[model samples]
Target: MKKKTKIIISVVAFVVAAIVTTGYIIISGMQKNLDNLKSIESNDVDLSKISDGTYSGSYKVLPISVEVSVTVKDHKITAIDLLKHDNGKGKAAETIINDVIKADSLKVDAVTGATYSSKVILLAIEDALSIATETNNK
Candidate 1:
């Protein structure tokens, strides 16, 4: 083969290998993140044990993350503010906060189309309330 043809072929092969490697890494990370999210189980927190105050928490599962501020008053979840949410096609999952406030619990159903996002949000809320529970226990 001509020297120029060999060089061109080598470059093309290198580019293909780079692309394939990058794709594999991304897919692998995504699969691992999904598995982590699936394994997340929101803990049952006792609201009555939580004091009246606002607490902050966050949960991240690559490509999806949530930060929440939960307000408790008279042992009830008065409100939930989503400080930050990084999601793909899960914007609708924000409404899950309302369901949580209404139920005053973390056992609410995940949003239909945004189940992953919903779970992350719930976990963040749980994280925040868990702090309160811990504080009260001390």
Candidate 2:
């Protein structure tokens, strides 16, 4: 084979390998995130045990992540503010926060077409409330 031809072939092979490796890593990460979502279980917070204040928490699943502050007042969940939300095609999931506040629980149903985002958001909320309860108990 000619030297130039050999160099071209090597370059093409390297490019193909790099692309394949990147694709594999991305796919694996996404699968891991999906698995994490599937395993998610929102913990219930005892509002009565939590002090009246704002608490913050976060949850991340590769491409999706959420950070939220939960407000407690009079032993009730008064509001939830999303500090940060990174989602892909899951912008609609933001509305689920209102539902959660209205329901006063994290057991609310996920938004359509944004289940993973919804789960992460709920998990973050659960963590925030859990922290509040823990701090008040301490």
Candidate 3:
């Protein structure tokens, strides 16, 4: 009976340790993604110069990623097309282009159920806009 009790305790401890380690890894990964999102916000590419031609932008967020191409003419956005999107149940994020077209800016709100994907899509669009603005500047 003594030996059996010791074995059970050890097994429980091992299982608890495994669970804790897994949780830690998951939390750390989540933090890193959050940090990346913060970095995107800081890039601060001016949208005013986004004129003419088509530009592409992409951003990866672990299980999901976004690739968007935007067309602009005379400083107005003509179209927004999804070159690639690894969205998971985030069909709402697909409307990023339409929202930007309606607002004429990236300050629009994210879709309720697909907030993360929406932000990522917006970030990709921001990246495309950055490139477009840079090219126009040159």
Candidate 4:
């Protein structure tokens, strides 16, 4: 009976260890992706160079990601739509879109306590605008 109990305990320990190791690996990878996103530099959009149109962009950073569509009209950012935002405890960041539209720039401050989500959202906007510029130049 003691032998059987010990075998069961050993198997349970092994299973637990495997699960823990896998979880740790996934978490670490996610952290790396987050750090990379945090390190990204955002630049202001040059609306003057971009033709009036809607531009779509997306940025992903593990637990957080954002997709945005920006509308430009007469050399101004007229509207912004957040098509998708996958955030963890960063719902407040969604409000940043309004700030962007009001300010007509990505220079607006990030949402407090949701800094990562804020940056991702801004980056997505920048990406969309940048693509517009690229497309125009081509």
How many backbone clashes does every candidate have? Answer: 0, 0, 0, 0
Query: Model 3: which residue pairs collide?
Result: none
Tens digits of per-residue lDDT, candidate 3, 1-115, equal 9999999999999999999999999879976885676555514455566667889988888656989888877777778899888866877878766988887678887788887
Models 1 onward score TM values of 0.91, 0.92, 0.70, 0.92
lDDT of each: 0.92, 0.90, 0.80, 0.92
Candidate 4: Cα lDDT at 12: 100
Query: Looking at candidate 4, what is the lDDT of residue 11?
Result: 100
**Model 2: runs farther than 4 Å from truth?**
none
Candidate 3 has a TM-score of: 0.70
Report model 1's TM-score to 2 decimal places: 0.91
Q: Which stretches of candidate 3 lie over 4 Å from their true place?
A: 1-28, 31-48
**Model 4, range 8-121, lDDT digits (tens) per residue?**
999999999999999999999988988887778779988889999999999888899899999999978999999999998889999999999888899999999999899999
Candidate 2, residues 38-136: lDDT per residue as tens digits? 877887777879888999999989888899999999988899999999988889999999998898888899999998998999999998998887788
